[model samples]
Target: MSEEPPRRRTIRDVAKAAGVSISTASNALNGIGRTNPETREKVRRIAEQIGFRPNALARSLLTKRSHSIGIITNDTYGRLTLPMTAGVSEALVDHGVSAFLCATNNDPRLAQLHLEALLDKQVDGIIFTATRADLTPPIDLTRLAIPVVYAFAIGPPTAPTFIPDDAQGARLAVQHLLDRGYRRILHITGLEDYLAAQLRAETYRDLAGAELDVLFGEWTEEWGHEAVRLVMERGGDLPEAIFCGSDEIARGVIDALRDRGLKVPEDVAVVGFDNWRVIATQTRPPLTTIDMELKELGRRAGLAMLDLTRGLPVEPGITRLPCSLVVRRSCGA
Candidate 1:
C-alpha cells in the first residue's frame, strides 16, 4: 500500500556524473593522491548538487581509517558533557566523521569497558572529558596507542589537555565589581580542596588585597546563605560587593541579602561564576557571571584529535582557554 523510497546515490554515480575515472573521483572526493585541484573542486561541486554521499564503511576500508571518533566522559549530569559533546559533534560532522559518546558516570569498571569497546570499534582517536576540569583518571592514559586528548579532564603531563582558565575567570568576576567602583568585595566559593575554588580564591585575594574577605564552604546555596550570616556575626564590615564561585551560590547570597533588607546592585552588587543559565537567568535581578567557554573547548579538543590522527603535530601541554564575563543587571553595569 506504500511506495518504496527511490535508490540512494552512490560514489559510482558521482564518478560517472563528474566525467572522471572511479579512482580519480575517489581521490578528488577525499582530497588526496594528487588529484587536480580544479578537478577536485568540480567533483565536490557535482557531488553536492547530486546529493552523493560516500559509503563510510567502504571508504574506511579503502583509506584504513574508521572516520569515527570516541568521546569518553564521566559527567553523568550532562551539565558539562552535553554542551562539549555538541561542539565535538559539530566539528566532526563538518569533516564527514561520526562520533560515539560513552558515559562512564565515575564508575571505574564502566570506564574501562567503554575504553576497550571504543578500541574494538577501531575509532580514529579518543577524547576524555568530564564535569571537573581537574579530574584525573585512575587508568593509565599514557599507554594508549591512538591519539588521546583531555577536554576539561586531566591526563598525563605530556598529553594535550584543554581546560578553562579558572584564575582568569576569577579575575574577571572580581574586577567587574571593582570596575563598578565596589572596592571592598567578599569572595564566597565552593570547597577549598577544589582546584576551581582555589584558583578563584587566589585571584580574588590578589586583586582585592586588604579589602578581601574570603569564605570557603560547600558549593551549595545553604553554604552561601550561611557565609553571609557568619560575616554579619563576626562584626566585619559588610562588603560593597560579593563575588560568588557559582551561580547557585550567588542565588543564595542574593536571597540572604534580600532577607537582610538589602537591595541587590543598590545595597550590594553580586557577581557569580559559571554562567549556568538555569540559575543565572532566574535570579531576582538576574546574574552577571563568567562563562567557561566549554563548548569552544570541546570544538578545539575534537579538532586536536583529528590533527593527531592525520599525523599533524599538536603541541602537548595544558591549553588554558580564556573565560568571558557576561554582564547583567546584578553587577550594576
Candidate 2:
C-alpha cells in the first residue's frame, strides 16, 4: 500500500550526468584542484540539478577536519551560558563550522563524560563556559589534546580565558552617576566573596571615597529592599542615587524607593548592572545598566578556538572584554 521515495542523488550521478569523473565533480563543487572554467561550471550545474550533496563524513575523512567544535557548560539556569553559546555558534557558523553543546550541571563526572564523548567525535576544539565569571569547572582542561578556550570561565593561569571587564563596567556605572551630578551615590551589590561584587565595590569606593557608601550583601531583590530600609533607619542623608550590582537588586531598590514616596531620576537616580531584559526592562521606570557583552565575549572565544585549531597563534592568559552603559529612564537619560 506504501510506495518508497526515490533514492537520493549521489556524486557519481552528477559525474555521470556531466560526463566527468567523480573526482573532477567533487573538485569542481568543493573548489579544490584547478579545473578549466567551462568544465567546472558544467559539473557544478549538473550537481546542482541532480541535488547531489557531499557526505560530511566522507569529506571529513578526506580533509582530516571535522569542522565541529564542542561547547561545555555548567549553567543550569542558562543566564550566562545561553548568550555565550549563541555568540560562539554564530561565529563558528560563519566559518562553516558547527558546535556541540553539553551541560555538566556542575558535576565533575558528567563533565568528563561529555569531554570524552566530544573528543571521540573528533571535534576540532572545545570551549569551556561557566555560570560565574570567576568560576573554574572541575574538568582538567589543559590535558585535552584538542584546542580549548575558556569563555566566561576561569581556567589555569596560562590558559586562554575570556571574560567581561567587571572593573571597567563598574567604572562606567559610577562615572555615569557622577556625570548626572549625583554626588551622594550609594553602591549596593552581591556577596563579598564574588569577584565581580568586590570589583564593583572597589571601583565605587575609589570614585566616591567618603562621600558615598558601598553595601555588600546577597544578590537578591530582598537584600536590596532591606539595604534601603537599613539606610533609611540610620537617619542620615539619603543617597541621591543608587548603583546596584544586578538588575534584580535594582528592581528591589526601585520598589523600596517608591514605597518611601521617592520618584526615580527626579528625587533619586538608579543604575543597575547586567542589563538582564526581564528584570531591567520591567522595573518601574526601566533600568539604566551596564551590559557585560557576554555574547561578544563568546564570539571572540569561538574565533580564538578556531584560530588555535588552525595552528594560528592566540595569546594565552585572561582577556577582559569591555562592557557598555545602557542608559534608560531610571538614570534620567
Candidate 3:
C-alpha cells in the first residue's frame, strides 16, 4: 500500500511548535489581534517551517466572503470575451480572488442555467460579456441578489455597462488621415444597423461634412473589394484615403487597390478598425487601425464589480472608454 500521505500541518501544530496559544498563533499568522512584531515573526517562521496552510473554506466561512466571482459570456466565438476575461482574471487574482467562466453560446436558457449555478455557488458578484459591444443581457439582471456588471454589452437602464467609445475612435482615425493631408477621404463600413457602425459613420460626417463619401455594406472582405471596384469604376476624383470598418475589409481594399496598380500610402492611404492582429499585420502594407482596448475594459469591469461587492457606490449606466489609434504602414505613419 502507498505510504499514507503525511498528515497536513495545521495551525495547532504551528502553535505547539512556537510555544504559543492557538489564538495567538491564528492572530499572528493572519496579522490580527495586534500581536507584537517579534511574536508575529516567530509564529510565521514556525508555520512556514511546518508547512502549515490555512483552510480557505474555513476562513471564508468566518469572513463570509468566498473571494470568487463568476463571468458569463454569450460569445460563441470568444472574439470579445477572451480578452475581457483575461483582464478580469488578472485584476481579480491580484486581490486574491478567483474567477469562474461560463460560455452560454447566446442561448438564453443556457445563460439562465449558468447564472443560477453561479448564484448557488455564492459568488461575490457576476460579470456579463458578449461578442458585440451593444448587446443587452438576455436575462433580467435586476432580479439578482449579487452585484452584476456588464462588459462589452449593455444591461437594463439601471445596470452599469462598459463599452468602447466608438465615436472617439472614429474621430481618432479621421483626424489622423486629415493630419496627413488626406482631404478626399472615404468611409467604407459594415451594416448600418449596428450601433458601432452608426456611431462611427456619424462621427466621420461630423468632422468631414456631407460631401465625403460614405459606403455602408457587410463587414466582410468581399464587401470591401466590391466597394473599391465600384469606386474605381465610377471614375471621379479618387479618395486620397480609405477608412475601412474592419481589418478584414481593409485587407480587401488594399488587395483591390494593388490589383488596380495603385501604390498604398503613395497613391492612396488606408486605415481599418478592430486592430485584429492576424489580418492587420499580414496586409501588404500592414493596416493602421483603431484598438478597442478590450482588456482594459475588462479590468475596469472587474474593479467595478469589486467595488459593488464591497458596498462601495458606483455610478450606474454606460461608461464609455476611449479607443486608441494603432499606426502602421498602411497610413504612412
- Top candidate when judged by TM-score against the true structure: 1
What's the true lDDT of residue 284 in model 2? 89
lDDT of 3 by residue, 92-210 (tens): 88666888999998788998999889888899999999877777677777788889899988777677899999999999999999999888889999988889999999999888777
Per-residue error at 13 for model 2, in Å? Answer: 3.1
Kindly report which residue stretches of model 1 are placed more than 4 angstroms away from their true locations once superposed: 1-4, 210-212
The count of residue-pair clashes in candidate 1 stands at: 0
As a whole number from 0 to 100, the lDDT of residue 155 in candidate 1 is 75
With candidate 2 superimposed using the best TM-score fit, by how many Å does residue 200's alpha carbon deviate from the native? 1.7
- The runs of at least 3 residues in candidate 2 whose Cα sits more than 4 Å from the true structure, single-residue gaps closed, are 1-4, 16-20, 28-50
Instruction: Estimate the lDDT of model 1.
Output: 0.88
| TM value for model 2 | 0.92
RMSD of each: 1.8, 2.3, 2.6
lDDT tens digits, residue span 208-320, model 2: 77676688898899998998999899888988899999998999999999999999989999999999998898898999999999899999999898899889999998999
What is candidate 2's CA lDDT for residue 59?
Answer: 78
TM per candidate comes to 0.94, 0.92, 0.90
Candidates' C-alpha lDDT: 0.88, 0.89, 0.89
Better of 1 and 2 by TM-score: 1
For residues 1-333, write the lDDT of model 1, one tens digit per residue: 999987898888889999999889999998779998999999999999999988877788888899989898888888888888888887788887888998988888898999899999899998999877787774556788898999998777778999999999999998888777989899999988888888888899999985656798988899889988897788867889999999889999999999999899999999998889998999989999999998999999988988998899998999999999999999886
